[model samples]
Target chain A: MTIHYPKGMHHTSQVTNMMRTGKTTKKALTFSRRGMGLEEEINVANDFYLANRLAVIHKKPTPITIVNVDYPARSAAKITEAYFKQASTTDYNGVYQGHYIDFDAKETKNKTSFPLKNFHQHQIDHLANVLSQGGLGFVIIKFTSLNENYVYPASHLIYEWQLHKGKQSISYETIVTHSYRIPESLTPSLDYLVALDEWLAHINK
Target chain B: MTIHYPKGMHHTSQVTNMMRTGKTTKKALTFSRRGMGLEEEINVANDFYLANRLAVIHKKPTPITIVNVDYPARSAAKITEAYFKQASTTDYNGVYQGHYIDFDAKETKNKTSFPLKNFHQHQIDHLANVLSQGGLGFVIIKFTSLNENYVYPASHLIYEWQLHKGKQSISYETIVTHSYRIPESLTPSLDYLVALDEWLAHINK
Candidate 1:
């Protein structure tokens, strides 16, 4: 039976989509190679950085409110009921070179523009708060169809979100102009820290 | 039937203990007031700081490995099966005054010493990593029986944990000497940031 799970909750949906297409051609192979979710790519990069002692970043677990549990005699405790809770902060945060880094990762299939709806009000508020406290706050946006990624400063995002400009979203051209491009690579799939360093250097200058 | 839930899993157990004792005297009232769990007290303090824009600290939600979810028609998705997962890092962390702050809260009933068993190996390693990254790392320890709270540096905790000294825990006297005392108050309850400032000054000096 098919189930309609909330966004970010059902990872299996991506797998299902792949299975339905069932294309084994070269283009399909390339599609599968680049089809990894943004979250997974970030996790892999984090693991690499952690192992090398470069930084200690982590993705906060999805929040859930547990209501009931069952414990058997010789097994692990099992949660019988729970519900997801809306997150008040961004998904990723940690310390990097004495700097507090906070950001949320998002991906869009849109070819022309990135929708502002991808960001929640609380997340925007959280990034603003982190920035006010002198921490570095940003968002990692991936244009899936175009296979492009950008590390956009949270300050610009907040401005764009609140500006009520005729456009409800940020055009690709604006993103390319305002954000630092994250060159994709093999070792750290996302290689976002490079973009982060650039952003940091730009702000310090 | 009584269930032996793991530590930090059953908050209701504290309430159960209170109900079982059935104490309503003046002394019991005092006990209840001071009996608020260390986690809850820290949460209250964090809320006060956030409201006043003093800090952006947050307690991460407990991690759970969800296995099954069910979505009923016109209703929110329900987590049908899940299991608690061991945390990979500290519980509370955020930007404080441009300093990346990371810490875990723990309480002990023993009056003489804080047991090393109260800390997990991963937590110690995580603290060490954060400290190495130039972030502020510490543990908020509460001696429940004594109604005393301390903001103890993670450096000291790591030292004692790895020293293999004759004792299995840090003596109360040692903690008093190396830690900053957090005085309880009405609004914030646990004013740990004051202790943190003191720690920072001492380290800088």
Candidate 2:
């Protein structure tokens, strides 16, 4: 996991080289960027978007069930016994431009393909349910090794999951062809909304 | 409180009287209904709505911040230290008939007015933000003494909250005049969606 942290010296050197050459390739640009976790990036982006009043989105807090709580004088109540609970819906959802938006973000170390096992049956079902209600539903997949992220439509994922028997993964090629790449950017950091807009336009067509 | 629970024998006797007379008033109906908490009632209604494919509403789990966890061998992770966190948004939100729905539910024993103190500033801000983004935002108020529930639009609540300086509450009279009543029902228990539908129709007019 430490290895995944941005190599500070190596990254700085690459930026210096790129500056001196006055030209940089996409790979060089990607390598120069820090390897922030997908969830954190999205959260930062959400905060930025919210501050700008561009969209009202939130990552639902992780669900937990509590068995006991202790109260002390003049202090906040402390949970004593609790366990994580499986979420029934996606991790993220809110309203954007009058459209209901819902999605989950996942980061995978696999470079060749994204395993379907990363998604739970209930989440897939939840996405399908939201879609039927005319809401936009999707998943953000970050290929950690490749340092790339894509916004994959829940409809497409559900189709593949249901249509195939024992086929356990979606290949990188298929993902690249079908999904919109979320570009790395400043301010909002990871501008997934741009990818979302592109996907929305494509689907509307 | 135990006093809040529906009186079993007293309630049964009332029902028996109503049955003997073949006349059940609205008050009788309200009294006969179990005194389930507002949150629990909404959860039950949401479950019914989900199962029937009528709506995709859900009660967002109570937010908590965990500080420590213990992993016992061959056992699920146990949360050892945690504390509740104030939620930034409403308790319930989802999609219904292509409309984004967002709201919080509160129950009060006050027969005259619903106290504004029931809401937090952030929750109010969140509702305003979502409403601006074209989502339907509202608060559901259950008058425990009256056994009546009303869906009060966030627009009205926001207006009152902003306009009235030092005013502490919204009178029940104003609520009844301006909001839709959520009726007690069979399949979905407390059918707030029907009130929502009515509210939507009224607003569209």
* Deviation in Å, model 2, residue A95 alpha carbon: 0.5
Model 1, stretches more than 4 Å misplaced? Answer: A1-33, A165-167, B1-32, B165-167
For candidate 2, lDDT tens digit of each residue in A1-205?
Answer: 0112122222222235345435355445555456667888899989977876778899998999999999989999999999999999999999887889999999899999999889888998999999888899999999988877899988888987897632599989988888988765544556687787677667779
lDDT of 1 by residue, B133-182 (tens): 88999999998888888999999999998894423899999998998887
Q: What is the lDDT of candidate 1?
A: 0.81
Compute each candidate's TM-score over C-alphas.
0.83, 0.85
Docking class of 2: medium
- What docking class should model 1 receive? medium
Stretches of candidate 2 above 4 Å error? A1-35, A165-167, B1-32
Please state the error at residue A27 of candidate 2 in Å: 9.3
- Which candidate should be chosen as best, given lDDT against the real structure? 1
